[model samples]
Target chain A: MLAFLLDPAALSGPADGASDMHPTRQRLISVATRLFQQRGYHAIGLAEILALSETPKGSLYHHFPGGKPELAEACVTRIAESSLAAIDRLSGSGLDMIGFLRRLAEVTAAWLQRTDWLDGSLLAVIGQEQGGVNGPLSEAVRIAYQRIEMRLARWLMAEGVAVARARDMAATIIAAQEGALVLARSRHDAAPVTLVTDMLCTMVDRG
Target chain B: MLAFLLDPAALSGPADGASDMHPTRQRLISVATRLFQQRGYHAIGLAEILALSETPKGSLYHHFPGGKPELAEACVTRIAESSLAAIDRLSGSGLDMIGFLRRLAEVTAAWLQRTDWLDGSLLAVIGQEQGGVNGPLSEAVRIAYQRIEMRLARWLMAEGVAVARARDMAATIIAAQEGALVLARSRHDAAPVTLVTDMLCTMVDRG
Candidate 1:
């Protein structure tokens, strides 16, 4: 296996060493994630991913035995971890939970701006594509959402909201963020991201 | 050109009559909308559309000179008009604005229950796909959203909310629905849909 470079965010997990990965596998994953993010999943091909990664066919399969599906799973897992870490880091700050949420809002707005509104979260793309089909990718999508939802729920609980209300609010918070991204992307303005986040934060705080 | 069997929901628009349509064009639009909504825009092929619609290849080109893009535009427009009518009808029931919104929540829930959550409002799909892309599709998406936002703003104004707040709330409410649908689709549950609409309705009513 090529050496997998540990993402700073993923370092908290058990795989502390860069020992396990082949360099080509790491390159393949990074390239796949960006391609999948820009175009819908089915719209892309293995050759494109391999070419983009500059890895040979044998090396590509050498790491991901399951081919495209395996690579996709790895990409989803990596992206999910990175995203969760960012959210956790923001929310884990010493500030109050509401303040943490506000900070998250800012990060999300910045993300929309930085990507020029083209980057819908990877889990989201998978969620939309596999929404109808029942498969591992779909499961991966669910697990990713659950991770975010659980984290948000915990933050809301820390803020003293009821468990049920907190879960609902977390879901609403997510919806607002996702929808705001859609709007910002379409409008080419990050203004909606900020506005939606503020309104949701207000709703959470008022409760 | 096959005759369009008018759906009351579809026909409420300003250009409702089959008298106005070239029969083949009407059939193509109706067939394309169903296929696109059921199986996504890219997954369905032109041959399948022509076969199912019983329209010849020549007629398809005659109607949609720009081919898939043109057909896609027609589908978006038809669905957009149909959606606006549905929203209008639901919001126009003798119920006040709040009541109308509440019923809309229920109606939407019922609608989701009927389909396998497949035929999402087309505007929402276009909104996501064309959000950051500058093109005719993007403009059409923006205009469709503007229409929804305007109707929602009117409802909020009737509820005695201040104008600016109403507009802000209108945008947020729309965002919530779009976002909530994404969430609901991800989780394969109507709960998020109900939760978002309920929470927003309460938020609006309290204000």
Candidate 2:
């Protein structure tokens, strides 16, 4: 069942020191992100991350002093930032609110298909897995979600929606999308996300 | 970090053979369901469940000979049944769709508060956790969501929503609520769900 880890391109990266994006440190985060996303925090071990990222334990400790949780936090933060960037890109793509929502849903569907349908957001998976169970990680997860909600609400306000409605819509959009992704991932299908987007666009039009 | 396992109400059951509800087998399911809901499938071990439920190895083996996955599947099924029953009860209540959603959100919020906000569903936590990782469990989760969606759609259709629209609204309501729960757990707060409920009620009204 763990056969999903047998990625052919997993080891194709440089010998740990050649990444122009972030060197060995970034490599570890990228691989760990995917591993944690594919499996989960408990199911994954640090040794597996080292092996997959082609990094040694010494270097791993050097980068992430708190070990697995620390590395996982970095992964969560990374996912949060990248997700916000995606939101900003779509928000500013000149699409109307409905069009933006459709584009966002399509992008998420494409991502689910691209990742072998693993998942769309690491924070979301981790948040659900760790929430109320892991205190410190849950705090970080909460902050990440809060930031996304804030940005989403702000974007809606810019679109001429009222402040309160914008905030409510933002909350609704995030919850709907995340929940739809969970349903979609279960069936290995992306139809749920698109359907939710259609429903949300109708809501937006009414607003 | 694992101190959350220390539930005061955990061991109050009538010692093994005294449960009028389901005997030792039912007790085992109740305990395991909470454990799996708080932590994902991989994070929770059989030893913990047995220890907490006060069940011996032989009894556990007698009921769930297939071990962890089997027990987890049972938990998912129980949650699905209980959840659908709630949906049915709420649908049958004299409340309109708006009042129905408000009551649903309030009930979920109270559940979160009651559980110290651990989470409200084992299937959602496990679905997000095991979706792309574990094939059998994912299929089970998919079936449960489909059942809930079907029932929800039927209820809305009874309430005068068009067939196709009822289906979309049901999908939207499920996604929004599940996603809202994840957010709520992160902060040990229920506001996200309530806020999403408000937004959903409006969509529901417009429909």
Candidate 3:
């Protein structure tokens, strides 16, 4: 679900820390992703991101010539990649379908509580902020969500669910998770997500 | 769900044309609600709302002493009232649980297609944009959602579901519907919401 935005991968630079990549550029992405997740896309400014990242004011343009939108695009892509990686890791862990979902929900709920409910799935924020608008950022948001859905569908299919049913269930789970996160944030509590987790578990058990 | 933003009441002046209320104020609220639903709360400016509402540039502060935040408060309240009215109308129709949920989803899907997916629930947008922050606007957003949830729970209870389960189902339904709307808007199709409707119907039938 959109909970992938809360993954530590979203806040860290590339795993290898290749010498060719500038550390400042990675820092900027990390800061921007954090801010975007906590606040809506439009509520944040480039100046704040640069200051928080400790990058030189003029260097933002040097690294991202396209400015805010360009930086936003990079953050979206980073989040998507990190989220897909997390899903792959979970899927490979040998947990049953219900076990995997429960673990995912627990991680998400913990993150929400840790952050004081200030952060949620960046994909959800961006999707709502920029959905239906044709742009690189919007396209990035769409792709991120699709990747999560596909990964979930694969996990469901591996559990012996029919292809069509797996896909539908994956979509429903993703949608339900995203919605529950919103409710959790709004109510300043994680119980909504817990309820959703139970509901999804029941559905999986029924099948 | 957040689908109430698509209600015509959200875009029109108060019903029964009160003699004391200024039409310009009503127009401003209507325009602001529409823009806020389509775009994030922080992305839109007062100038744009006033221009679209056809209100005089100087009259904005006169109608809304608190400026954009105050205006946002009014829009939130208007949406909540309109949404409650919609729920009341649906409940009074005496449709069975599945029938009512399916009809609600169908109407929401039709609205998404009508606006070409440019609009969604104002409550969803505000809840994501301002939730977890302390302010009147954020509080208003919370109240709006709670009202919707309560109305839904009341319907479920009326259908013989236990109170605890009814509340949980209400929250799940609201969250799922909001999430499905985001998915549908992002994918530029109503199939996501249609899938959600089916999932919701099954859950309701089970109860």
Candidate 4:
């Protein structure tokens, strides 16, 4: 289910073996993303990230010279790219629009349950906490969310919805899912997310 | 728009003069609420709150003996009470369900614009950041959100919807609005929120 929101491949390591494959660097990025998603960006410090990643202090500066901000930016970029790819893959599948939305919701709910509600979409956390405070991080989050919205909009358009309508529907879907995830996590239950999924399906089917 | 999510009266001060009228304490609560809403719960420090509130250190400990956590709880409680009161006022105003939601969206959008998207729902910031991390704070946030949801459900029930269906729809409405607010704040525009509002009104009107 997390794959629907963030690609596991991106979290683990680089897709291409061309470079950027240092085990220490990959571990740092992976751990940082998890910590940021779980505990928020500001709450987690560089020492914690370093200690959790088990990477040396020297290696941290070597990989990310700009420190926490630089590392956060990298995590956001990777997650964004992976999420966009996942969207493309899902949209290209043989399922119709309604089917796609149902599948997406199921995966999301399952992911939330699996994580014990400790994590939600990275985009959501970033968008909520860091959106306006940090310039580069905020921009990265915006781009990530916009890319996902555009991907959803394209799917709606393919199903015969008008351009403007498709865009609006896409925004609604993303926003609703994000909000439901927070509710679900807060209550430690998946019912909120499931309810939202059903509503989205109904609305899209009617359209 | 903020009045739709959080009552400005709550943000500023008490509407009545019957009691609970400690100006220093009230000022502390108000400033803490705004800071927590704009930045986040963990991001804002007690010292900063003191500086912003312009209250003495001894006074902070005097009013909120439990320190930052106590102050945060007070803020959450006050905001929740004010928000519920605002909803009551809106629902009692004789507007249909659609009209109520449109007004809510408009007010929320305008608030976002007015604050340059730096501020969103206090419940949202608390629910997203402190939820699942701080036990007391999480519970406070949950109660705040649930109270709002129940108020919304009551409105739907008054419109002749069944109890169970009304409850689910209310949850959906809150979740969607919360999510759209994040998107709007992230993009530094209110278009996303406006789109969600229109869709919500359509759904409620049809039902």
lDDT score, candidate 2, position A139: 74
lDDT of 3 by residue, B94-129 (tens): 898899888888888888988888887777778888
From the highest TM-score down, the ranking of the candidates is: 3, 4, 2, 1
- Runs in model 2 with CA error above 4 Å? A1-22, B1-22
Candidate 3 lands at a TM-score of 0.94
Off by over 4 Å in 3: A5-10, A13-20, B13-20
TM-score of each: 0.85, 0.86, 0.94, 0.93
Off by over 4 Å in 1: A1-20, B1-19
Question: Comparing to the true complex, what docking class would candidate 3 get?
Answer: medium
Residue A56 Cα positional deviation in candidate 4, in Å, after optimal superposition: 1.8
Retained true contacts (fraction), each candidate: 0.39, 0.69, 0.60, 0.58
Instruction: Rank candidates, DockQ, best first.
Output: 3, 4, 2, 1
lDDT of 4 by residue, B93-195 (tens): 9988888888888888878887778776677766666545758888988887788788878878988989998988888888888888888988898987888
A78-143, model 2: which lDDT tens digit per residue? Answer: 666665665676677788899888777766787778777774456667776785766677677778
The local distance difference test score of each candidate is 0.66, 0.73, 0.80, 0.76
DockQ score for model 2: 0.59
Residue A78 in model 3: lDDT = 77
Report the TM-score for the A-chain of model 2.
0.87
